[model samples]
Target: MTATIDRAHAAARRGPVARAYRFELVKLVSQWRIRLLALACWIAPALFVAAVSRQSTLPVDTLFGRWMHATGWAGSLVMLGFAGTWALPLLMSLVAGDVFAAEDRLGTWRHLLVAVRSPRRIFAAKTLASLTVILLLVAGLAVSSAAGGILAVGNQPLVGLDGHLLAAPDAAGRVLLAWVCVLAPTLALAGIGLLGSVALVRSPMGLLLPVLLALALQLAQMLPLPVAVRLALPGYTFIAWTGLFTSPAQPGPLLIGIAVSVVWAATATALAYLLFLRRDFTNPAHDGPGRRAVTLGVLPLAALVAATVAVVAAAGATGPGIEQDKVQRSVATAFSHLYRLQTAQLNRPDVTEAQLAATAACNKGGGRLDARGPGNDWRCVVTWHLPGIEAAGTAVYQLDITPDGRFMADGDGPKEVNGYFLVRTPTGDAPNPLWQFDGNVALLPAAPKG
Candidate 1:
């Protein structure tokens, strides 16, 4: 009978509860913590950009994909990764943590609770307000990062991982898409911070703890952690999937990374809700047996995951060469579409013995007929026949590889011919998909062709 009366009274206080929740926004913004958080979020990216500009380790030329990423949209994505990893999450935590703790710190939480009459409703309102702020901060960071990256670097052609360069227009579109991908990872961390804030009521360090945790998880990801465990870490979607900018794009890893970020965020949020519901308001919030157990539960899980990864790595390293076999299998499977070599050279009724031998050798060598220096296995080849003078001419072109792969036969034969070749990797005998080459390459005023 008494419990029913108390429940009815609590239900009747809905108007004051709603007002207290709205006031949380005004209270959170006025704090110096909010100012510091905003600065941290903005400055972290700016510092990274400065570091990139001043750093000497990154070369300006084609040292693999380094120069290309530093040059355009790729550069901006790099800055966003570092910023998004901890900066955005930490900023949200700063406000969210204070939302609960600030009331306790002011010693006004008790008074507000009596006015609101419902603890659960107040908690919900506080959480929603903080989450809204987190979303805005992240959006601001994204816009600023894009603007800075385009201005500092320029929207130039992105040299893809496959070593092909992309023009500025294409690069711009990718930058926008990549920035949006970061939101999932950020949201997960923000959820974690909110949970910590709710559980630990008044500690300023509660906000800082999630930031430290985010950093730790990132470091773990770089180590020999299992793929399953690595996926749980925030911001991994940025790297595992972002590498498609490399040549021969692979989306498998990226898809998996996004899946992992989504799952991690969802699970963390569920655990948070459980903690909030079970907590005792009248007990005055000590890190007591209840909170201690929740914290300790994470320990065995971390160790078990860590040990499993270490054992798997050690076992794989000790065993017979499975990794090598996997690579060989993947390469062979990737090239399975390549076909047998056939040639119809010039007006000659039959190809000369030399031409036939060259084609045979090239086929056996996986399409690279480079009889000189180191060899390559790309199988797109082009051969041409024309009457030629004493200049170098195309004896063979492998159209099966990207970034154009082939060898030219220097013509001492005076066949008076010019042959051009266009290659795309491992595609079977089509007459020509399309060929992009100009024999003259460049031209000037009235140079007579004899």
Candidate 2:
């Protein structure tokens, strides 16, 4: 009797919310699934780095995948991008989606309520516990991936998309920053899962609902929706960290990503909190007034959709592609710069701009429309020369320019220009040692047309 009284006294002193929070934390850490997930977060990247290190070909499609086999820092960034797409949502949902539903599944709601006077405190405790788990998991993945990549491939100078080279320390710092940047989206995904968990009241629905929602949002980004809508999506923010790897690092996308993620997370969490407040844990069937509960629930969803439509309408239609004169001038200048870089790598004499005598004739869709703006239909015929190569063979360039004046060009020219070019080294002929400007080239701003 004395022990029971002491226990009661201790519980009373601690307060109901604090005690519930402690209970939730204990339950969360004790679960086998959470343990396995934490272990996987640390071990999976090591295995991935080890296995990919053995491969011959690099994954060029992904932002940093092309350098993974050769650079450890690149490999970590590649893994971070890959994880954001689906793995992150699944990991967050593992605990969050089941946090509330599990209580119902195990018939422990009554016991929990008996221990905790207020249901609101119990709800807050569970949400806090799930969020805490997400935070730890993200930190673990970042550390493991960085450590694993360094161990597997070694810290090498990382090449940016614009052909800039970052030193080992700088590369590592940027890669870690990229990993840290993804936490915004991860937290947003966790909140989504928590909201689903409370609303669905079934473990499986809660788990799969957030995952499906995330997948749908990802697919929507591919559609030709307004820029505002695309920017608002969680998936778009996932890749925003790539900007950190660029020269003069672009922060606009990263800032927008963080803001959008915060809004999404806050909105979802607020809705979940409201729903939990109204829920009747003692009797599963009756959860406040059904009509009023649904109206409140639908408000969040309606707000999201209405905001998307409003932004899309406000942005107006997409602008026309870049002008033809602008494209020709931009292409000629960029091509000359790229050729000079190539020549420098070969230990060959630099080609003068006057010697380049570069001339470009561009057309869009085989002359179907005015080649004035950005589009994939652009094709430019460029003529330039090296000492040995003939000017007779014109380089056929396919260019795609963004509305923001950024462009990527691919040319059907000499094989020497395609992959690793041969350079004159002191010790016989060797492959060009630095990052090649083969894939993408950023152009200088075109001069104002007269």
Candidate 3:
């Protein structure tokens, strides 16, 4: 009897949020769907690594796919790029979008509300639990993919986006950091899903709405919008990880991306909270907030939308687009690194990047010299000095650049010197470092116009 009383006191001391969070967590874990989702997260990455590693053709289009067979770090980065596009948003939506709505479907809203008198506490508990589950799933995927890649292909140094090489240890640390960075935008995305769950009430609508919204935003990002508008988007955060692999490891743009995502998340969650507090659960017949209440809630949502747009537009007016000078420097630097690697592989005289003296002349479509902004038609003529060659050689590289400052350069090279698609190295035939490569420029706002 004394022990039971003590236990009761101990439970009370743990606080309501803790108790509710534990209860929510237990409920989520017990669900078969959640378990299956966890299982898939664990198993899918391993399978993907094994399957891709065995293929003869490399997935060259993906950021790190060219080196997937060369290093486990590359495989992990490849998966990160792919997952950022679709898998992550869908996975987050599945959990956060259903947490609140499930109570409506099960006719348990009143029971839950009665059990937790404070609606605010209930919201905190469920949100925390859902976020916890998301973190677990992400961690599981990262581990499984990394382990599988290492098992399939031995851990080796990785080639950075700027053509610099990262040793295995440094690469591992960066890979881990990259995944950690993913959580910011992912949480922001989860907030949107949570908002849907609270507002939609119906399980199916709650689950699918966030995913559709995310898809729409992703498509919007592809449009040739103003740089500021694109930068303000939550979807841009997904590609923010690219900055971590650059030569100087610029976190400035990545931090800005995170800030934009945080603003979106905080606003969405606030709106969801406002709606949740105003809702009336007494009427079992009603599935969601009252019509009048919804109208009132929408006023704030609309205001938020307008404010966000205004701020983004103002920023866009001052933000820098992909500039010609930055592109030339970025391409030229990467070309020098690739040239060094190509020469080293051929057992030729060792040449340093400084000795190479690489430079690039870039132009956009319509033969616009010194062209600025993102497009597919950008072309660069890159020239470099090489030992044992009489005159300098030039390579024409076709560049497809994105709004986020990442570009893929495809070289129409002098194959006799640089090797075409494949290079004969002492180790074996490998993808020519100079044939094609990726690069990133800093995305920052320009000086405000006078």
Per-model TM-score versus the true fold: 0.58, 0.78, 0.90
Please list the C-alpha lDDT of all candidates, in the order they appear: 0.48, 0.69, 0.81
- Candidate 2 segments whose C-alpha is farther than 4 A from its true place: 1-16, 284-294, 308-411, 419-450
Once superposed on the true structure, which residue ranges of model 3 sit more than 4 Å away at CA? 1-14, 290-320, 366-370, 387-390, 417-419, 445-450
Model 1 lDDT tens row, 92-155: 5676545666665666656767776666777767776776677666666666565655666666
lDDT order of candidates, top first? 3, 2, 1
lDDT of 2 at 77: 78
lDDT of 2 by residue, 40-86 (tens): 88888878866786677666556667677667887777778778887
Task: Report each candidate's C-alpha RMSD, comma-separated, in the order given.
Answer: 14.2, 6.4, 3.9
What candidate 1 gets wrong by more than 4 Å, as runs, is: 1-21, 39-65, 68-72, 84-86, 202-205, 232-235, 247-249, 283-450
- Pitting candidate 1 against candidate 3, the one with the higher TM-score is 3
For residues 72-172, what per-residue lDDT tens digits would candidate 3 score against the true structure? 88888888887788888888788998999888888898889889888998899999999899999999888888888888897888889898888999999
| Residue 33's lDDT in candidate 3 | 87
The residue-level lDDT of candidate 1 at 215 comes to 77
